[model samples]
Target: MELQNRREFGKKMLGTTLNYFLLESLFTSQAFASSVRPVATHWAKQLTEICNDLKLQKIPPVLWQQQVEKLFNQIELPELLKFIDFETLTRGFDYPDLGVNTRMVKFPKLDGLPEKTVFIRKIFGMKKGRAIIPHGHSNMSSAHLVLKGEFALKHYDKVAEEDKYLLIKPTIEKTAGVGSSSSVSDEKNNIHWFIANTETAFTFDVIMVDLGGKAYDIHNIDIAAGEKAGNGLIRAAKLDVETALKKYGKQHH
Candidate 1:
């Protein structure tokens, strides 16, 4: 009986010690990670943290929008752009001028930053009277922050999906200037249209399409051609890239 008691005590001590070590290790790792990627007005890092949390499914997509809006509201556009090396990049960068859509540019992540691969970061530039077009996606979420000029931004909540159309209802319509922003998720504010209202407009974006490990789909909605649905909704047809740009990009109003 004495030997049995001793064995039980030893087992209990071992379990306690293991738990203590495990907790210590966890705290240590968290601290190390925090040091490696401090998030003090480092706009990119904060965005990455959210992207990581998002891809891990720790936070729902709808909540991702709130966090992104908060971040954009907190940071200045020039500061954010400098961190991402935007001026250096566009100094000599060139692209074919588009009459209807944005020019998407992918810049390298700042060196020494911790890796966060769940999302793709990009800058979309547009001429006045051009747009980002109206589009909805599956298994994706994105945030767009106006960095250069103004845009007439519109958002829609996808009500239903059919073989050829996405039934959606308008959710937000407003003029967005520098530091203004919008975000999209699969279930909320799913379709977004951005028409540049300035001579030149730029938006820095973080897009994650590989949610749930399933293939993502981009459905460009032809808003004007959408069939009227009851209850202030519209069944918009999906369009090809060329068609979408030509059709919706030049529509300023």
Candidate 2:
């Protein structure tokens, strides 16, 4: 009877110890997740402030680019994703079999904010071999941050104008992935394209525009059909939104 009691006590103690460890682990993980919330909150506040200031100050495009890059460089990929509530922001669209699809992160509607204030954020989800069709912004500025996977980005300087086409001079071409960021403005490397180099990829963009100014237009270009215009410049053919979307919509399944 004494041996039976001892065995029962031993089993009870082992079970208690196991339960205690499991609870401890669960609490630790929750605590860790909570600890990162503040960091994410800080980033959200900072971005809001920057966008607000841009609206009031209308800072030069170069300065705007520099400020945005500085802020983005401070955070690494893991930290960026940790605080971001992807489930809340994401609309959960069906991923296209090929090419890229954009999902806009819905910003909470704020009281007293103007109806036309241009503050936009979006995620570009891309499948491998698909590309973000070449396009340029009009009277706007944007920052692109690679949140996941890999992409090959090419930028071109809209140097001069030919009769109906923009004479674009190749600026820089490079591969970018998590932690990589780039910016575009009305001036500078405004014309750009990104090709997904991984099985799946995502890019986060914060875009600000002057709604009262001109309706921002994405001037699309066809690189394959571009003609050399000397001095390393190429005259790219302009493509309407519908044509551009149809042609570069899909590359592979």
Candidate 3:
């Protein structure tokens, strides 16, 4: 009987140790995931699909987000937690252009829209005529929400492609109607470029929706001399709201 009691105690101790180990492992995994960036490919593919659908079908962004939220909510918590929170990433970059004099705060998740991937980004002390370099998404598209000042966006298309040089030209396609949102097959207007203009250093929000799974998609092309007409341009487009404001300010002031 004494031996039986000892065996029972041993079993209980073993169980307790196992429970502790499991809890520790869970905590460690959560910590690891929180620190890691989301895999770019997974998020970029989905986001690209969304952009194409919106541009082609003329579907509203809000409605698209709703559908995405539903799909993402079904993802396991471990996978869902992999994203870098906007507030967190903002703190890492130092922006003097947007007059971001204060620390950034992650926009709180709206109660019903738990799956919407939204962020409120700020660039402090920004001004007009500043240069925004060319870049492209290996997988995403972004929208600038003018929270504070005005911004100008110039979309460029690759006019020519060459092994030695990259040639590009600017084009503006007014995205006013529904069909504008649905057409994604031809994204010639969605190429490489930059942004800049004149405005007071201020802050604005950029809603960077993922195209596949990456943070930013930058495609930098090299426009070399003697390149054939068919291949003379490199394209990298950027959207900075502050640049738009600068243009507006110049016109009014």
Candidate 4:
């Protein structure tokens, strides 16, 4: 009888081990047998999971976009503000002309957010008439959620690339308000520009770049100087960062 009992106990342990491995593989792209989890967080753990999947390319881009948009729409804005101490960060902040002030978002130790995250998270602040400039990204994915005020948000689909310009057409242009959100990837809506429409506007950003360890680039454009191409397209001349900021940053009219 003791021998039989030992056999039963061994079977039970094997079953439990299989169950654990199954769950681990399901949660991550890599099988548990070989994979190590990148980072852990107590605050915004769900966000971290999504970003991990994004970096791993475990989900489709459309699905990722939907997930990010739904996440912010469902976020408890008030709770988030309190958690991040938004008021303390933005209070008495000096405004910049035509550009945004970028602040890194750090989850407090008390909140159990690790010093390192799966990806970059940021808060961008802009004064009225200021803009984040027109830019396109490659080999990256990002999401922006409006936390306060409003922005004249615009998006353009990449048509073609020139030696010195990006040919794009407007795909989205709207006054995005609090809780409004959008996602960008090279696959869709690769280009974006944000102009603050209210006294002050703030957006919380989720950024994941170089998912496949490929070279990534940001193309800043001088939209004002671009000649209109046919079919509502514009051939926006690319500009260096300093030149783009100087030309496009002041009080976006």
Clashes of each: 0, 0, 64, 1
lDDT of 4 by residue, 1-253 (tens): 9999999999999999999988886664333212212222323767777777877888766677778777777767876675566887888877887589988776544334456876897899988888899999878888999999999989998889999999998899899999899988877898999998899899989887776778778999987788999999999999998888887776633
- lDDT computed for candidate 3: 0.40
Off by over 4 Å in 3: 1-105, 115-125, 150-152, 159-167, 173-188, 192-195, 201-216, 221-253
lDDT of 1 by residue, 1-253 (tens): 9999999999999999999999998896566445433333366667778888998999999889899889888876555665565785456444334434334444333345455466787788767887888899899999988888899999999988999889999999999998888999997999999888888888888888879888898999889888888999999998998888777767544
Specify the poorest-scoring 10-residue window by lDDT in model 2. Answer: 107-116
Best by TM-score: 4
Candidate 2 per-residue C-alpha lDDT over 141-226 given as tens digits, one digit per residue, 9 for 90 to 100: 88989988899999988886555588888887999988899988867888888988898788888898863366776688887689
TM-scores, all candidates, are: 0.77, 0.75, 0.37, 0.77
In lDDT terms, which candidate is top?
A: 4
Total clashes, candidate 1? Answer: 0
TM-score winner between candidates 1 and 2: 1
How does each model score on lDDT?
A: 0.79, 0.76, 0.40, 0.80
Candidate ranking (TM-score, best to worst): 4, 1, 2, 3
Clashes of 2: 0
Candidate 4: residue 185 lDDT (0-100): 83
Answer with 2 or 3, whichever has the higher lDDT: 2
State the TM-score for model 1: 0.77
Local accuracy of candidate 3 as per-residue lDDT tens digits, 1-253: 9999999999999999999999998886666544442433444345445555654545554455444444343333334323424334444455444223334433322222224344333333234533333333333334432222333444555454444333565465232211112111123444422233434323332334443343444444432122344343443223344543243222332
- Worst 10-residue lDDT window for candidate 4 reads 33-42
